[model samples]
Target: MVTVLIVDDHPSFRTSARRVLEDAGYQVIGEAHDGQSALAAARVLRPAVILLDVQLPDLDGFEVALQLTADEDAPAVVLTSSREGNEFGGLVAASRARGFLPKDEVSGPALAALLR
Candidate 1:
């Protein structure tokens, strides 16, 4: 099973995402409520992928993705947001994230497909 770290400021979304991913056969190692914690968790947990929220309290997902993907062997990042990807105005396409998934479309299959 692929290991994943979920990053989002909303507790409800994190909980829901954990359940959805776990049901879809993904191993959820940890969750972070902010970008700082997400970065710290990534360093320690070193999950295979990170489901990062686009609008974080500390640093935006793009900033976090840049730092995360800077390292060799960095985990794949899949950006997520309640808003549509086009709303970001090419920011999502330009990010180091592997891909973008809208919040409502966050399924195990969708995430796995993005990683592939």
Candidate 2:
């Protein structure tokens, strides 16, 4: 099973993401509300993938992605957010994320497919 870490501030989104990923056969290893905690969790858990929200309160997702990807054992990072348009897409490209998933477009099966 693929291990995953979810980092998002909104309670509802976080809960929904966990349920969706878990139902799709991925192991929901950890959840973090801010970039700081996400980094800590990543270090401890070493998940196979990280679903990160771009508008995190503590730190932006791009910065988190940079740090995480810089790590020797970095996991694949998929940036997710409600924001849509070229601006966000440009940032995702610049950050070198494995992929960017629009919050509205993500479902259990879609997320599972992205992981594969």
Candidate 3:
């Protein structure tokens, strides 16, 4: 099964997203409320992909993506937001994320296809 680390500042969103992805066949390995915690958890769990929220309290998702992808063993990153993907503009492309997913549409197949 594909393993995942989900990063979102909203507790409710994290819980719901976990349920959604798990039901869709992804193993959710860990959850983080901020960029620092997400990065720390990723280092330990080494999930195959990270579903990261675009807006975060500590550090925004783009910055997190930049740091995450710099790792030699970097996990595939899929950024998310309630906003449309184009709203992030060039930052998404520059961040090296696999793609963006609207927060409401996140799922195992969506993430898997993006990673592919």
Best by TM-score: 1
Which pairs of residues collide in model 2? none
Model 3: runs farther than 4 Å from truth? none
Q: Write candidate 2's Cα lDDT for 1-116 as tens digits.
A: 98999999998998888888788788899999999999999999999999999898989889999998996668989889897735664778888668888887766677767667
**Candidate 3: residue 70 lDDT (0-100):** 94
Predicted candidate 3 versus true structure: per-residue lDDT over 9-106, tens digit per residue = 99999999999999998999999999999989988999999999989898878998998889777899999999999997898888889999999988
- Return model 2's CA RMSD, one decimal: 1.5
Better of 2 and 3 by lDDT: 3
What lDDT is obtained when candidate 2 is compared to the true structure?
0.85
Error of 1 at 39 (Å): 0.4
Task: State which candidate, 1 or 3, has the greater lDDT.
Answer: 1
By summed lDDT, which 10 consecutive residues of candidate 3 come out lowest?
104-113
Residue pairs in collision within model 1: none
